[model samples]
Target: MTLRNQVLIWIAFFIVLMLALWIFRGILLPFVVGATLAYLLNPLVNQLQKWRFSRGWATAVVLLSVVAIILGLFFMLVPLAGQQVGGLIQRLPGYASDLQELARRWAPELNAWLGPEQAARLEATISDLLGRIVGFAGGITGEILASGWGVITTIGIVVFTPVVAFYILLDWEGMVRGVNNLLPVQYKDEIRGILAEIDSSMAGVIRGQGSVILILAVFYATALSLAGLNFGLAIGLIGGLFSFVPYVGFAIGFLLSMGVAIVQFWPNWWMVAVIFAIYMVGQFLEGNILYPKLVGSSININPVWLMFALLAFSLLFGFVGLLLAVPLAAIGGVLVRYGVRKYKASALYLGENGDKGGDQTAV
Candidate 1:
């Protein structure tokens, strides 16, 4: 194919793929989740294969072991998190009352500092804010569920994800070979090189970052729980999970931990200080130790570019887009660099003499 024709064909293919994803987005969640699982678990299957297991048997064993681990974690953690959530909801009113009393106790100082009129305005504002917080806290779960409950049901995901993962894992090698066979003959080697780069980038960012998130979650959850903060487990897990979004996770975990500590142990002050110290230590460990060791060198995408890609994809394709954003961003980054390299080497970039002459003679 001519260069222009090849470009057109690839563009058309990309457009068609995007159109299909948009059209079938609602039902795509399970498949996307399954594919992601398969990708993550592929290494384990490869390890088993090295031990002389057939592909089918390896896949089955890995999936079963994963299922068992998930079930155990689900049963053990879900109930405790749920209890914490319920207790937090129940205590909102009491927390509000206590906060109000605390504010009132400082009323004299506030009046002396700000004058009666400003202090009165501040008190009224605080009351209104507290009321809004309580109301929002009470309904946030229901609001989230009502908005997202139908996107992918619990039953559908649980039933379909494993089946999709299994078949994909079993046929993984053949599928790779099939795709490789379809590459254009002229650019096959170059395309393969790009694919290799994409694979490396994906493995670095996704797998390495995954390890970072898991470690952070465990650390936060364990530390908070050991510190005896109310709803520590939930706070730690949520913070850890949210760490996928960068600094957002640390902010969320710290704020939630501190908020709970203040409410549960206000007069004592020591416990609140302990919670603050835990978060500080966690942040230090993540920033200085974990991220650098696992993810620093591997990340080629700029943070600003990453955030933009995530926001753009999420807006375009909702949840499925969010799931795909990282991999797609990595692919796009590699392709862009390849394009720039090609461009820089072309005659157009060097006044038509670059390709024919050595670098010393180029414009």
Candidate 2:
């Protein structure tokens, strides 16, 4: 095919793929989840195959192990998380009142520093902002928990996803070969290189960072709860979950922990110090150990771009979009970089002179 024809064909293919995704979005969740699980677990299956096990046995073993782990965690942690969530919601009003009381105590110092009018305004602003924040937090939390439970209770996901994932895992190599066979001969190598890059990015983000998030979540929740910090479990889980975005998780957890610590343990000073110490340790492990060991330099995506992709995808496709956002973002990032490289090498970018110096300058 002519280059233009090839380009048009690919464009049409993408459009149709997107249309299909949109048209069948409601039923795509289980499939997407299954596919993601398969992707993450494929390496384990591969390892087992390397050990001379059949693919089917390897897949079954891996899937069964994962299911056991998930069920164990669900049974152990879900009840506590649920109770904590309920308690947090129920205490929102009391927390608000406490915050306002804390603010009232600061009124004297504020008045002395900035005079009555400004302090009054500042205090009112703080109170209003606090109320708004608390209200929003409560509402969003309830909705999120409800939606999450609804998804968990979904019969299709519970029943069908395993079958989908099992077959996909069993035939993973064959599927890969099939796709490889379809690639145009002329562009096969280049396309394969791009796919490899995408694979690396996806693996780093999903498997590596996923490990990081899970470890951090467990560490934070356990440590904070042990430290007796109010709402520690919730704060830790949130912080750990946000850790995928770099410093965001730390910042959020720190702020929430500190706020709660101050509110709950103001005069103790030492306990507050202890909370700070726990986060410092967690940060140290994440920065020095977990990220270095697991993630390394494989993920080249910018945090800003990742966040934008998440927001955009979530808005466009809801929960399914959220599940797809990171993988798609990785693919998008690889393609964009490839396009840029191609653009820089083209005569159009090189100009009539075909200056190599321009390429260096572009770099």
Candidate 3:
């Protein structure tokens, strides 16, 4: 095929693939999750292979060990998480009452500053918020129900994901080789270079981000739990997990910790400041220590763009979309860099008149 036709054919193939994915997205959850796992475990599998293990043995060892670890954590923490969630649920009513009482205590000052109408409105808003907090206690369960995932879905993830992952892992090398074999010989080197760049980028992001989040989670959870916040561990875990998307995780964790601290340590009140300080310390450690040491990337992406990718993917593909978004965004970034390099060399950009726009970025 001519080069233009080949390009068109590739574009058409991807379009069809995307359309198929969109159409059957509901059923793709397990496969997506499985593929993500395969990608993550591929490094370990490759390392084991280097140690002279067959691909099968490497995959089996990695998958079995990983599953065991996951199961262990689930069994170990589920009870604790359930206990914490239960306690929080039970105390939510009292927390709501305390908030109302606190609001009433400030009513005099609020009224003086804002006038009766606005003060009353403020009180109503407070009540509404507390009501939602009460609703949130309920919403936690409600949201689960609203998600439409049930026992079967859980089983699907637990069962089929490993099976799919195993096949992918088993054939991972063949898959890569197969794709390379299909590439046009003329562009194979260029494409292989791009794939190498992508693999390097992915490794840095995945392994580094995973370690960073785990470290932050441990730090935040331990600190908050020791500080005696009622739901600190849960809050910290959430914060740490969300940290993958920049400051989002920390902000969320901080807000929850603050709310819980206010509810649990009210009247005394200094505990709230203590909780805030814990988050500040966590943020400091993350910014100054963890990210610098772990995620020292040569090509730094804009946080704004990262946030945009997260939101855009979440909007388009829900949770699974969110899972795919970051890597896709990273890959997109790499592609954009390549496109820019090409554009810089092209007459359209350099101009037929050759305006000499200086050197192009080689990101």
Highest TM-score, which number? 2
Q: How close is candidate 1 to the true structure, as a TM-score?
A: 0.84
Higher-lDDT candidate among 1 and 3? 1
For model 2, residues 1-363, the per-residue Cα lDDT tens digits are 765797798799889987888787768888998998999999999999999999999999999999889889889988988788678667767776786798789889989999999999988886786677578667667655554447554778888889889999999999999999999899899899988998998898889989999999999999999999888898788889878765778986886787678789977989999999999999999999999899887887898999898878777776787778878888888888988998788788897788978868777
Worst lDDT 10-window in candidate 3: 354-363
Q: Give each prediction's root-mean-square deviation over alpha carbons.
A: 4.1, 2.8, 4.1
Q: After superposing candidate 3 on the true structure, give the runs of residues whose Cα lies further than 4 Å from its correct spot.
A: 1-14, 86-97, 107-144, 353-363
Off by over 4 Å in 1: 86-152, 355-363
What is the clash count of model 1?
A: 0
TM-scores for the candidates: 0.84, 0.90, 0.84
Span of ten consecutive residues with least summed lDDT in model 2 = 144-153
Q: List candidate 2 stretches off by more than 4 Å.
A: 113-125, 142-153, 358-363
> Which tens-of-lDDT digit does each residue in 1-363 have in candidate 1?
666797798799899998998898778878988988898999999999999999999999999999899989989988988788778768767877877788789899999999999999998986787687668666656654653556456777889999999999999999999999998788899999988888888887678888888998899999999999888887788789778776878876776677678778978899999999999998898889998888876558877788888889877887678778877887888888988998787677655555545556643
List the global CA lDDT of all models. 0.83, 0.85, 0.80
Arranged by TM-score with the best first, the candidates are: 2, 1, 3
